[model samples]
Target: MGGFFTPDPPPPSPPPPPVIVTDPEAEAAQARQDAIARNRRGLAGTIATSETGLLQPSQGVGKSLLGE
Candidate 1:
């Protein structure tokens, strides 16, 4: 009879709580830094394309400012 019966252990407890804080100044500074990095990347890409002479006008666009 003992071999046919077995006991199960209880489930584990939940995890601990978390701490949260808010800082507006820090958030603004981070945003500014991110914008600067993005701008730099864009400028670098433009310069690289120009240096490689990859920029071209579309066909039949214009040969002169007046389209002459």
Candidate 2:
């Protein structure tokens, strides 16, 4: 068989290098501050509904039966 007709194997690739950071604590503190600011902007308060003006027809009968 001719060398030109034979298939050639591919070359090996180099491994990836590790990453090094200078300030890990500073990065964590900044992330916490961002989360707190986001939460404050989306916060909401609940409102209570009043029923003082609404009347029920059975209230008088129920009170008389119970001697209230």
Models, CA RMSD each: 8.2, 12.4
Those runs of model 2 whose alpha carbons end farther than 4 Å from true positions after fitting are 14-22, 44-68
| TM, every model | 0.43, 0.35
> Global CA lDDT of candidate 1, please?
0.69
Global lDDT of each candidate:
0.69, 0.61
- Candidate 1 lDDT trough over 10 residues, lowest sum: 1-10
Tens digits of per-residue lDDT, candidate 2, 1-68, equal 33787777666788788787769899999999998987785523121322332322445433454455
Error of 2 at 23 (Å): 2.7
* TM-score winner: 1
**1-68: candidate 1 lDDT, tens digit per residue:** 13446655566888887776869999999999998888887855656556435456546544646655
In model 2, which range of ten residues has the least summed lDDT? 45-54
The local lDDT score (0 to 100) that residue 56 gets in candidate 2 is 28
Q: What is the lDDT of residue 43 in candidate 2?
A: 28
